[model samples]
Target: MPSIDLQETGLRALNTTLQSVEQKDAAYTITNPMGAHAIACGLTHEINVTIEGHAGFYCAGMNQRANVTVKGHAGVGLAENMMSGTVRVTGNASQSAGATAHGGLLIIEGDASSRCGISMKGIDIVVGGSVGHMSGFMAQAGNLVICGDAGEALGDSIYEAVIYVQGTVESLGADCEEKPMDEEHIKSLTGLLALSGINAKAEAFKRYGSARTLYNFQPDNAGDY
Candidate 1:
């Protein structure tokens, strides 16, 4: 594994190397991130990057086929708009973690702040700790697995996304409601937990999703609109 110190090589040179390289399975270790923003954005190759310390905003934005791990905390919008690849944060994450992501998995070993998966298209996020209010707002399609409690207005106006919470939810959003977890859902949750290396029981989770009542415009329910 090639190791680069961000303090010496700079973030621009690191990202440039990741983007320009055509190697199949390159591995890199980044040290002294010191909460640097946009550390590894727009990578398209199947590589592995390990950040030894805290990272600032958009640590691995728009990543594809790369597996990036942050050993410490992450700033806002971590893994934002990612297309594919895995970004794992060993520590807490700020607001809007995995926002509008289209594919792949994002794992936060610690808590996540507000709007955890806002407008997420097809990403899968596994949070080991609690999430702040308005999580999964306008989510299109994806799975958000929260091992801990959820704050107010969870899944506000969400669409087609599945949210699984092991702890209590303060409140549900406009079109969100608790749903039954069938065998398939249980199996899926189990798989996700295993993949994320979370040691929680799948049966302990409660699923929340759209009520489908707001799929079409209803004049009688215009107050919510």
Candidate 2:
């Protein structure tokens, strides 16, 4: 394991060192992040990285194979456009967490701000706490598991993606509606919860997804578009 202090090595140099490492299952510990932007973006190796403190915007964006753990809160766009592997935040996250991610598992142990998992593509996000408004907006695929409450306009214009909320929902977005959970949903949710290490019952959640009404354009529903 190697430790890099952001206050000493600088951001670019730290990223360069992490990116350049080709060893499999290599581990790194980053100290004194101090809310720096893009702390460990674009890491393709199957390494493990631990951030000692808070991370700023776009932390761990475009990550592939590498596993990133944030010990503190994360700023906006956490794990944006990630390809694969895991990104875990032990504390709260700002808006648009896991936005436009392709494939990966994002675990937020605390609350997430507005637009969490917005425009997500094939990413599986598990939020241990609540999420703000407009979450899962225009999500194309994957699953968003919210262990706590959800704000207004949840899953607006959602496509194919599934949302599971264990707590209260303020409102549903356009084309989004509550759906019955079947055995398949239960199985998936069980796996996700177990993988995220969240002690929540799958049966306690309510499933929500696209009603498929807005898949095509309709003149009578122009306001929704």
Candidate 2 clashing pairs, residues 3+ apart or interchain: none
Expressed as tens digits, the lDDT of each residue in 42-68 for candidate 1 is: 999999999999999999999988999
> For candidate 2, lDDT tens digit of each residue in 53-155?
9999999999999999999999999999999999999999999999999999999999999999999999999999999999999999999999999999999
User: What would you estimate as the lDDT of candidate 2?
Assistant: 0.97
Error of 2 at 133 (Å): 0.4
Tell me each candidate's RMSD, in Å, in order: 1.1, 1.2
Using Cα atoms with residue i matched to residue i, what is each candidate's TM-score against the true structure?
Answer: 0.97, 0.98
State the displacement of the C-alpha of residue 83, model 2, in Å, after optimal TM-score superposition: 0.6
Q: Compute the lDDT of residue 151 as modeled in candidate 2.
A: 99
> Candidate 1 has what TM-score?
0.97
